[model samples]
Target: MNTRIAALAALFLAAPALAEAPAMTVMPSPGCGCCHAWADLARAEGYDVSIRETDVAALKDDLGITPGHRSCHTALVGGYVLEGHVPFDAVARLLAAQPAIAGLAVPGMPSGSPGMGDDPDARYDVIAFGGTAGAGEVFHEAGR
Candidate 1:
């Protein structure tokens, strides 16, 4: 009887820690409201989000985000870089799939993207970069 009680208590105590979501770090341009908005969006979606403000140009360069792949903000999640306002669902998918890629990028900020606005109909592509000589391919398409 005592053994059974101990087993049940152990399971209950470990449940919350096991169910905790992964953490995400976002580096956004200083004074960029949209970037903050996007961070809030990620937090709302169950990410343990942390935001840091920095020079966008220098940060982008440091992160190896070239001109074509540049965005207003950058994020690190599960060893992958998430550029711009990537959708929450796409992030969830990326973490679930655990693809062999550097990370996902949304490039420019689309009007209907997660932080830009709540437009479910907005069209965009989440790109996977850094796998093949720095070449990127589409990872997810919105409104498809």
Candidate 2:
């Protein structure tokens, strides 16, 4: 085999075993009941979740999420921001794809979003927000 081609083959062979799954850090207000509920849901799904209370506004700023894109909570997973009531399944998909996105946000207290509990007829959007306020696209939209 050509030396350069053999070296390339070796590198490719070793890549898969070194890959690591992405993890997210969840930050929520201490007294927020819904946040805890969301945390529980994440835990049940095998995510490495760490809970802490901090100034949400400051956290948002630290993550570079301006006021227009801010939500009730903040999460950091694999260089992605999980703002607000994002569901575990969607989060898993996000981590799996590892898209070029600033973060995933549910925005506001959506009636049936994860921790908010089940809604027989709830509609919400799992929006992917990027660098600016309008740099957002719908990843998932829940419906009745």
Best by TM-score: 1
Give lDDT tens digits, candidate 2, residues 1-144.
223323422432332221243344567876788887887777676665666567778667656666766667787665567888887667777767767667788888788887887563578888877744334888867762
Backbone clash numbers for all candidates listed: 0, 2
Worst 10 residues of 2 by lDDT: 9-18
Q: Weakest 10 consecutive residues, lDDT, candidate 1?
A: 9-18
Report the lDDT of model 2 for residue 21: 31
Clashing pairs in 2: 24-77, 25-76
Residue 144: error of model 1 in Å? 1.0
Q: Tens digit of lDDT per residue, candidate 1, span 15-79?
A: 23212666777788877899999999988888777766566686566556778877889887666
User: All candidates' lDDT scores?
Assistant: 0.74, 0.67
- Can you give the lDDT of residue 132 in candidate 1? 52
Q: Please report the candidate that would top lDDT against the real structure.
A: 1
